[model samples]
Target: MEVSKNAYYLVNDVLRAAKLYKLPSLAQLCRERLFSASPSSLFGGGVEALAGLEEIAEQDEKFSDKNSEDDPHKQVEIPGGSARTLNDDMKFALSDEVWADTVLIAEGHRIPVHRCMLVARSEYFRAVLAFRRSSTHLTTEAQVSNAMAVVNVEDSYAGIVRVLRFIYYDQVVLPSLNRKDAKGDSDGVEQEAERAEGAVNDYLAEEASDQLLEDLVAADKYRLERMKRLCEHAICVTVANCLEVLAVAELVHAAHLKQVAMRFVQTHLAQITAREEEFRRFQKDFPPLLEELYASLRDASREEFLLRIVH
Candidate 1:
């Protein structure tokens, strides 16, 4: 006979939708759904405590300047004033005692509140908890298998955490790229370039050649722009040193690293054009790869793909 505010709002929404859609059955279904539902309440004690702490911290920061100026010589005197210590000074200066108390209370009560809230509204936080559980499980499995000792991949827990957070919440957390220390005058450009090249060389040294190539392929597939660029630069440098390796890698990486390989081919087109005989010979050696490329082009949309035979 009596409906709560939430139920009344739901019923009103259903009626409004029904009038627009001209579906009376939809409204009836909504009412049946509401009447059959049981409501559960959650205590927001931990959240409230945290909110209060934050409010205290904000207030402290706001009034800190005025308080400091008003009492320059006023030191917080501890009981049995042997000497007011650094901890006492900081505690008094920051005025964080109240905030700390709030945090401690929140920490004590958080687990139970979170558990209750999670049970009540599991749908909202299900994906988050699932991701956290998956990450913890993966780490445990990796440890059991001695993955860290065996796998020689770059172990960036921070990077993985950031990527996971992004996937879970659609948020990016990229590091700043501005290298002011590395930049300088025109003559410094060569030194900077050499330093950059050396850094890449060092990174490659840490990783296996085949593994680096796989990472590049994965980066391209995932559309990781910075990583893709790094891989392209690495491949280009490798190709520059050993043209023969490029010719071989072109075939091996044709499928997964098509975009990068295509760009590499285009970059070295001038050299190939100059050595017409060698160009033909190289093409003959990888006839299968060329055919595959042509097939890919054919399958691609007409507007997107071009069939130009560049000599």
Candidate 2:
């Protein structure tokens, strides 16, 4: 289970692959090795390693100091300056109606947005606007341009808003889940008192999972590749959402995400199959995906058996 010092750089890449491949033991070992290994080991020993660590620490301190500043309107001072202020400004602009030239309607909810921002942030929006202008009559160009443009989008209000927020801030802002308080007392009454609270916590988790799925779908439709990958990472971390994410991945043709979810299912197949109700629903909705999962499981079993026999 021990990773060699020479293989430190490979540990992180191997960890990610191991997790995706459903090798929990290997992933855990890598995780422990990564956290336990010193910077000196990672960079190699001697004064050079010490100098590099100091340099990294100094850079991190400067970055932190810059972020801790209270100025929200600090202009970009250099090429690719820190974007905390810019992200804040863009988020403010997203809510400001005075300068917005376009309104995006999602699920009957009108969202005011700057055309320039959308065009700058999303290629899909840029192409859509370009097509509109090209197809419009020249006589009505001035009149149409002067008037506010309204575009109807066929996505849930929350989903569209999540995508818009990502476009504006370049961050995925997931809803915060409140942690349930742990009771010290082991009495039945104390445990009974927290049963309702536990239920509420479960509900919040489910809500967050649904929002993640929605964000994934929206990210895919809008062709936001980074956001899509982020959403997939978020979804893949939660085993409870694996089935749903797998279905969505199939629908969206997200090959990597589908593979990750398939592996998760394979790793936890016994527990997943134990939940007859949920498993049945997933099978009913995604029969092809279920078949693929079983095929992968069979292939994996065959490989494992052959390896054992060879050993």
Top-scoring candidate (TM-score)? 2
**Regions of candidate 1 where Cα sits further than 4 Å from its true position:** 1-159, 171-176, 181-257, 271-311
Local distance difference test, each candidate: 0.44, 0.77
Worst 10 residues of 1 by lDDT: 102-111
Error of 2 at 47 (Å): 46
Tens-digit per-residue lDDT, 162-270, candidate 1: 3223222333433333333455568789788779867866555434344445444444444454554454455433343233335445634443345655445555556
lDDT winner among the candidates?
2
Q: What are the models' TM-scores?
A: 0.25, 0.67
Residue 86 of model 2, lDDT score: 60
Over 78-159, each residue of candidate 2 has an lDDT whose tens digit, in order, gives 3354323566667788889998889999888899998887888788888887787777666775776766778889998888
